[model samples]
Target: MSASSAKVRTITRIAMFAAVLAVCSQIAIPLPSGVPVTLQTFAVGLVGYALGAKRGPLAVLVWCAVGLVGAPVFSNFMGGPAVLFGKTGGFIYGFLPMALLCGLAAEKELPGRIFLSAAGLLLCHLCGVLQFSLLTGMDLLKSALLVSLPYLVKDLISMALAERFAAALRRIPAFAHTKC
Candidate 1:
């Protein structure tokens, strides 16, 4: 393909993944600690694996920007600057780094992809726990136990699924030609 065409394709893919992130954010089940169990992380992993380090974080950033601008694209359809600065904001913001780290690792072999994705998720959880503790006036360790612990297994599952999905996608002609 021509250079311009390739760039357009990349941009289109980024936009599509951003939309997927927004959609996944809406599939949330609220928890008592005021955080939600959502598919956001799953989509984050998928975007990272599919789009790679450069494009993946762009998609995540776009989704975050949309939510920050009051598009109701966050968990439980919540959005706006208030949500961006709220207790759960750290997790949301952490998606950018997660995508970058995960995508970078995903460009390697399968084991590397899985390991890095888990690490990325851990980073996200750390951000969430820290912010949750700060905003809610709870002890940091307590917040980590309450908020981060409960979600570890599920997020791992999501990362595994994203890896599988990305592997499958890489076989397709369109994606096959694309590089991380």
Candidate 2:
């Protein structure tokens, strides 16, 4: 491919993954604590392995920027600056590091990948717990109990599935021969 085309391809992929994340975020089941069960984590995890460390985070950043600018790209189709800095904002911001860490997982063997991905999810949960606690005036333990703990198993499963899906994506012709 020409240099310009390659750049276009990269941009297109990033935008596409950002859209994927937006769609995933919208698949939310709202709860009493204001946290929602969504495929956002699954898609973020997929982005890391599918796009690699650098590009995955770029895609996530794009999604975040869109939402921050008032696009309805967050859970339950809600968005804007309010979502970015609101009750569950920590988890939203956490997606950055989450993608980065999961991207790093893509470089490892199966065990290491799972470990890193789990760690990344833990980090994301920690960010959520802290923010949820502070914003809601709940105790840290209570926030964790309510939001983080309940989701660990499901989120881990999502990460594993994301790895498989990413592997499948890598088998596609466009991804097979390209360094990007």
Candidate 3:
């Protein structure tokens, strides 16, 4: 492919992932606990790992912007400025930096390793929990115990599974240009 065509193809792929992320956000499985663990984050982490630093965060930015526009593109089909300002707002906004940080870690020479990806996801969880507590007036420790800890195993498994899935996707003709 020509250089410009390759670039366009790459952008198209990133946009596709962003759309997927938005859709994933809408499919929420409400937990008994106040925190609903959505598969959207799994897509966020996967985008970071699969698209590398630059395109990955760009994809997330697109997803977030779409969600902010009252698109019902978030967990529980929630969106709009109110959603951004709501108790879980921080976690929603936090996804940007989290995805970027994880993407950077997943793209860096040493940082892009699987271990770093895992660690980056852990940090994302921490940031989300802390922000969640601050927004909800809950204790940080309590937030961690209630919201973050329970999701640890699941997130780890999801990240690992995403890594594997991304690897396989990269081998496909259509997704060949995606960086995994």
- List candidate 2 stretches off by more than 4 Å: 109-111
Tens-place lDDT per residue, model 2, 1-180, is 799998898999899999999999989898887899999999999988888788989999999999999999999999899887788999988888899888888866666567777778888999988898988899999889998999889898999899899998888997767643
Our model 3 lands, by Cα RMSD against the true structure, at 2.3
Model 3 residue pairs with clashes: 106-112
Q: Give the CA lDDT, 0 to 100, for residue 40 in model 3.
A: 69
* Model 3 agreement with the true structure over 1-180: per-residue lDDT tens digits: 798998888879778999889877877778876568888668988888778777888898887788788888878888788877776676666666667666776666773466667766777777778777888788989888888898888887877777777767768877775454
Stretches of candidate 1 exceeding 4 Å from the true structure: 110-113
Q: How do the residues 1-180 of candidate 1 rate in per-residue lDDT, one tens digit apiece?
A: 899999899999999999999999899999898889999988999999889999999999999988888998999988899998899999997888889888988787765456677778889999988888999999999998998999889998998888788879999997888796
Q: TM-score for every candidate vs. truth?
A: 0.95, 0.95, 0.87
Candidate 1 lDDT for residue 175: 82
Model 3 residue 136 distance off true place after TM-score fit, in angstroms? 1.9
In angstroms, give how far residue 55 of model 3 lies from its true place: 0.6
lDDT of each: 0.89, 0.88, 0.76
Q: For model 2, what is the error of residue 160's alpha carbon versus the real structure, in angstroms, after optimal superposition?
A: 0.5
Comparison by TM-score, 2 against 3, better one: 2
Cα displacement (Å) at residue 61, model 1 = 0.4
Which regions of candidate 3 deviate over 4 angstroms? 104-112, 177-180
